[model samples]
Target chain A: MKSIRIVSDFNSNQLIRLWKNINNNIKFSNNDFNQVYQEFANYKNRNDITVFWTNAQRVIPSFNDLLEYKDFDENVCYDEVRNYAISLKTYHKEKSNISIVPSWHLPLDFKGIESQNWKFNYGPKFIISKMNMIMSEIFSQDENIYLIDSEIWFNDKIDLDINKLWYTVKVPYSNNIFLNSITTFNSILDGVLGKSKKIIILDLDNTLWGGIIGDDGIDGIKLGGHDYLGEAFLDFQKELKKLKRRGILLAICSKNNEKIAIDTIKNHSEMILKKDDFVTWRINWDDKATNIQSLMNEINLGLDSAVFLDDNPLERDLVKKALNEIEVPDLPLDPTNYSSFLRSLNYFESSTLTKEDFARSKMYKENIKRIESKKPNFSFDRWIKSTESKLKCIKINNSNIERAIQLFNKTNQMNLSTRRLNREEFLEWIKEKNRFVFLYSLKDRFGDLGIIGLVSLEINLKDAMIVDFILSCRAMGRNIENMILSHIRKFLIEKEKDSITAVYKKTSRNSPILDMLKKSDFEEITKYTFKRNNISIYFKSDPNIKFEEINDKN
Target chain B: MTIKQIVYKCLDEINLSLSDGDKLNKSKDELLIGDGGKLDSLALMIFLTDIEKNLKNHLNIDINVLDDKLMSNSNGPYKTIGTFIEYYEKKNEIN
Candidate 1:
């Protein structure tokens, strides 16, 4: 079982209870209250995730001096925060485990001089804000050290009854704040575990716009301009566009005339989402559940990766019952609340935003183009050759570590082991004797599919085992799998290894990997385990693709 | 609603946050504090704070459930759900 060691300044029993309520699989270790640095130094479990939660005044005595309106050097407070951050980073580098430090915030009702609080550097609020900024900047440099924005849990009203709770029970915040914090924490955990939703399937008629597109037509739909509902719909579309920009694939699953809907998306002045913004759409009169399944199949993504949004209750219920894996959120009755409600769900939370994430929708769109360009009678090999695909193999380093971790966790279908690891865990694993990882970025005439494959190897004596063989579904079925195996064989040969072995671990979605292994000329020594004695003769390079090896100088 | 109903409703609301095994029974005879109680010291604090907030919102009457008398009394206000309801009814009447 995965363990979480929570070390906090205040009593953390309530937080532990709430977190346990959220997830039972995790084993929690709540350290003694107000023993922040002691627990940090005492932490030895390299696999367990450590959470360092502290109240500003409790941890830093200089912060209390500032809070009391006494003369204090701001640099001292900053130095303390920096010390904590640097210590956490050093501990993380040593332990090679994840550490979460929540950004400190003053209480909502902190009574400071109203105008001077934000304007002056000496103000308590100002110092705390600056401290949080310093913490963000320093913590961001380390992948394992996560600095969560704790301020998001608070609001205009004081969430703490300082008089009753602080003195009586060492818990400062209200139960509501704790509840909200747990929810955000759960989202963060989901993001860290690579379980965040990737796609949003939207209904166009009443969902994307204010009115039904079938009956109202393009001109009659309430989209933008002076009307409140129109502006709301427009804003909602803008929110969806922003999600698309951040790599969440948008698709339409509406029962509508495809031509008319496409026309409205293209021609409508108020529509923020254009026709090309969607990677794929199933705008048909068929059952929406079937359409959604078909769209997922076409896009090569799982049903669990999608969040369906539809204003029609009947359609929502139908989709929810038919496609249980797909998350169908109940759209609010009012169109004005749609954008905020969607934002509140936090389905698209990502731990690290990479260049590939920004270009994800565009990459999928290009994949769709590649699919459409292929003739119905064209041979698979010829079609792949026609695309002029190129694979660049690069050793994993600091620059590509985040994206490498993302692919390691997200790819399921073509994965051999399906082992999930955070950046620190991965780095630590590779630091062991005779372990290496190769990341492959695929590019065709269509587009650059950024780092879609990862191959991990473990060498023992003259034999080498493929620890992890992961390829993104987007790059599959294009001779990329054959090329990856060939590349591995060549590397092992260069390393003077006698044989290369791969064991296919069976998962619900990983049958595709088994098929690839069978076709790649590996003799089945046992069930699910394949081995090749003559690595040079067994694996052949795909003539359709060109391979380049990139060395990381840094 | 009666005072008994209000207290029971608050208990039901608090049960939403509690784990399934730790959930408070709606029955008045159910133990609420000390041994055999669903709440520990921290949970009791949350329960009492929630009760005070609910009473203020629903009845517009503010009462401190954690008063000096209640803390010092051998027979505290929260011994069982029935005792808590009885104490709350008397407190509401006094208010």
Candidate 2:
């Protein structure tokens, strides 16, 4: 199980109350102390800032009782505290893992402006801003930290990432640091916040209007634009369209004749949503979950990320109770209040925002491009040759080891064995005198594929066990795997290590890797075990395979 | 108008007249998702949408009633028109 440490100022009771809601599995510590060193060990070992229950609870140590840099600066207590904290940090030197800033410090921006009034009895906003600044600093330093700015977390009201915003917003949080890691809660929050939902599985009849679209006929249905109830629904549809524009994949999963709903979405221009807005359309009597399943297969997103918006509470409850992971937001009784009511759903918050985030749903819209592009119009081999895809095959160096380990843990597909190794475990394995770690950075014509693949292995000089060989799904279908294996084989030939072995581990989210094994055509020693120790040193270069040098200098 | 009248009105809108016996049986937990108890999320979405419009028309009560606690409680107030009426009455009484 992945580990995270929560650092919060919640009294034991307050922490326990929210503990179950946030994470049932996370380990939490409720320690209140004036000394930084006393609270530094666990915070230094695990992931940063799990949960901080700073309900006006954080107090900066006496400004007078701190340290200075020079030795034996006995006169100034402030000097002593500062010096000691610095010494502890320097002695630890970049080992500070999970971190929290004391409430007293100002969040000094890059422009050097003090963000909040530091001298005043600053509320939770002080810590929240401090956390944001620190995260901004840490994320810049390394890519490992996926900073979810707490200010943006709860409607810009309670910046959970910042503690002082809580005092201002009156939002008390039980210190759950693993909120972003909780995918269901996060997805729901993301959905409600209008962050990322590809498919909006909607209902028919009363959902779209007052009566069933089939039973009531086109004019009979109560939609927002034309009739009284129709106006309210029109408001609802307008809100749905806004979400759709933000790259939310809209789909129809209703129990209605396809023609009527189609006519309404298509011909009904006064209607808020058009037929083209939804990437996938499923309007049949099939079970919503089954419809959802087909939609998920069609769109290729985890059900956990999709939001099912229906008018019937029963249908919502069925999906919620059945697939607890998929977010089934409670539809408000008042269609008129939907615009504001949807505002309150927690899953709508954007946790990690990158430029690529906005394009996922459009990519869903362009899934035809995604599929058709997968099969190159220029023909597979020609496309592979035309792009002149260069593979930068590099041996693991000290500077890249941490990133390599991260890729090892995170890369799902093309991961031969899915062997996840933390830094310590990886370092120990590397020092074993028999292991090799290789990271591949692929760059094609479109853009740079950043550190797309990695393979961690252990060979007894004569034979090797491929512990992990995973590549990102982004780099698939590029004949990339063929080139990666080619490099490994050539390296093995140089070392005279014969009979290389590999394993394929199965996971629910990773179906692409199964294809990787089949494509490589490995000799199956057993059901899931495959081995290929020898490749012809003179193996005819299938003109389909294009290879190039990946020297560190380049 | 009392929540009971509103509940009956809601039942009327959905075209399902709740009997006094069925009303009594309508506690929060047994509300199905799609049928009488279970509302297809679409129907629940539509049902809530219509209910809001009806509430505004008759009761003039502008309340935001669609959310996790409203529908997800094992004994959710949103479960039945009756339970919802009780919740509305209680919430208004507090207000």
Candidate 3:
């Protein structure tokens, strides 16, 4: 089981219990209070996550001097922050494990006039914000380090019940703050595990706009004019557009005439989302559940990766009953509350963004184009050759490591072993002798589908094994699967390895990998293991696709 | 609500955070903080703070449940739910 070691300045036994209530698989380990530095230096687990949290005053006692209006040296605070960052960096360099640290913030009841507190250099708020900025700048460069924004957990009212609980017990925060912080931490963990939702299936009519397009013609729909309700609907659409830019695919599942809806979306002067913004849609008079299923299939995504939004309660109920795995949030009664409600859901949390994420919706649109181009009687080879696809093999490095890790965790169907790893673990694995990871970015005449495949190999003397073979579903068809195998075989041949083997572990979603392996002429060593000798010339690079390799100086 | 009802309602709020094994009993004679108490030192503080907040919200009565009088009592008012309710009634009368 994965474990979390919490090193904090305050008592965290309660926090451990709260986390356990949320997730049972994780084992939480708490250290003594006020041992943040000691715990950071002593922690040795390379496989577990460690969290370091501290009150600024507690960690740097000199800050207390400033708090009490006594003489204080700002250099002391900077020196302490530097020392802490050094310890964190040293620990990370040695262990290469994930570490979470909450940014420093003043207590909720800290008495300071807003105008004067922020203006003075040595004010508590000023000092804490500066320290937090320095800490974030230093920690964010490390891929394995996560600096949580603690302010988001607090409100205008005091979250820390200092009068009632601070002195008697070490717990400074109220129950509500603890619960909210734990929820945010849980969602971050979900994002790290690649469990965050990817797509938003939205309904038209009352959902995206103020009225049904069937009854209210294109110009009659209330959206993006001087009207308050129309402005609210427009704001909601803008919120969705922001989410779309963050790599969450938007899809339409409306029961309306396709021409009218598409026309409205294309020509509506105030519409925030255009036709190209959506990856795919199913706008027919069919059950929303079936439409959603068809949309997911068309994009090669699972139901769990989607969140459904419908203003109609009956339609929401039907979809909920039909697909329990998909998330269908209850829309509030008022249109103005829609944007805030969607933001409150926190279903699309991501640890970081990459180039692939910025262009995800466009990539899906390109895939759909490729799908639509195929004729019913077209041969597979002829169709693939017509696309003029190119696959560029890039070595995994600091620049592209984040996307590589994302692909490793997110790709399920085309994965060989379905192994999951965080940034540090993945980097450490690749650093070992005779281990190599190569990422492949595919593009066609339609568009550039960003880095969508990852392959890692481990060599032992003359024998080599493919540790991970993951390809995004967007690049699954078009002979890329066979081309990846051929590339692996060619690389092994160049390395003078005698043979290469792949073990297909059976997962509920990984049968596609097994199917591809069986078709590639790998001799079956066991029911799950496949092997091909170096002398075997059964697999060949696809002539329809051009391949290039770029080596990195690691 | 009466003092006893307010105390029980506060306990119900605290119970939501407690595990099944650590939940506080709602009976009047149940021990709260001293010997045989369901709460540890941390839980005891949270329980008292929750009661204080709830009392102010429900009755507009500002009282510190952890005052020195209760701490100094040889047979503390926090021994059982009944004793705590009696102490709160006396404190409310003083207010």
Q: What would the per-residue lDDT of candidate 1 be over residues A1-554, giving only the tens digit for each residue?
A: 88887778888887787777778888888767777788668866664677778888888878888888777999898999898777767766776467778888885567777877776678787889898888888877788678888887886253554457777788877767877877877777777888899999999977899765644567888999999999999999999998998899999998665777798899998889988889989875555777787788787777889999998665676677667788999999899999999889977878888999989998987875322321223244554566678899999888999999998777766789989899889988999879999999988774687899999999999999999999875566567888888889889889888898899998755766887888778899999999999776766778878899989867
Worst 10 residues of 1 chain A by lDDT: A369-378
lDDT, candidate 3, A13-66, per-residue tens: 777766776677888887777777777778666646777767887887777777
Stretches of candidate 2 above 4 Å error?
A10-13, A20-22, A34-43, A52-198, A215-220, A226-231, A317-325, A348-350, A368-554, B1-95
Backbone clashes, candidate 1: 0
DockQ pick, better of 1 and 3: 3
Segments in model 3 whose C-alpha atoms lie over 4 Å from true places: A156-158, A368-554, B1-9, B24-37, B67-95
Give fnat for candidates 1, 2 and onward, in order: 0.32, 0.00, 0.36
CA lDDT of every candidate: 0.80, 0.55, 0.80
Better of 2 and 3 by lDDT: 3
- Indicate the docking level reached by candidate 2: incorrect
User: iRMS of every model, one decimal?
Assistant: 2.2, 16.7, 1.9
lDDT of 2 by residue, A1-554 (tens): 32334334433333332434445554445445333345554434443333332321132232211111123222242333344434334323344333332222222111222464342323224333443444345344443233443332233221233232232222233123323224433443334334564567777666666665543456666775546677877877777776666556678788655766788677665677777777776775434655666666677667777788886654565466556668888877777776666655554444445556567556777773322112111233544565556677777777777779777776543566667789898788789777777888877664576777887777775877777777764465456776777777777778788777777787533445655566574677887787785654443344654456555543
Lowest lDDT sum, 10 consecutive residues, model 2 chain A, at A369-378
Give me the displacement of residue A511 in model 3, in angstroms: 42
The TM-score that candidate 3 achieves is: 0.67
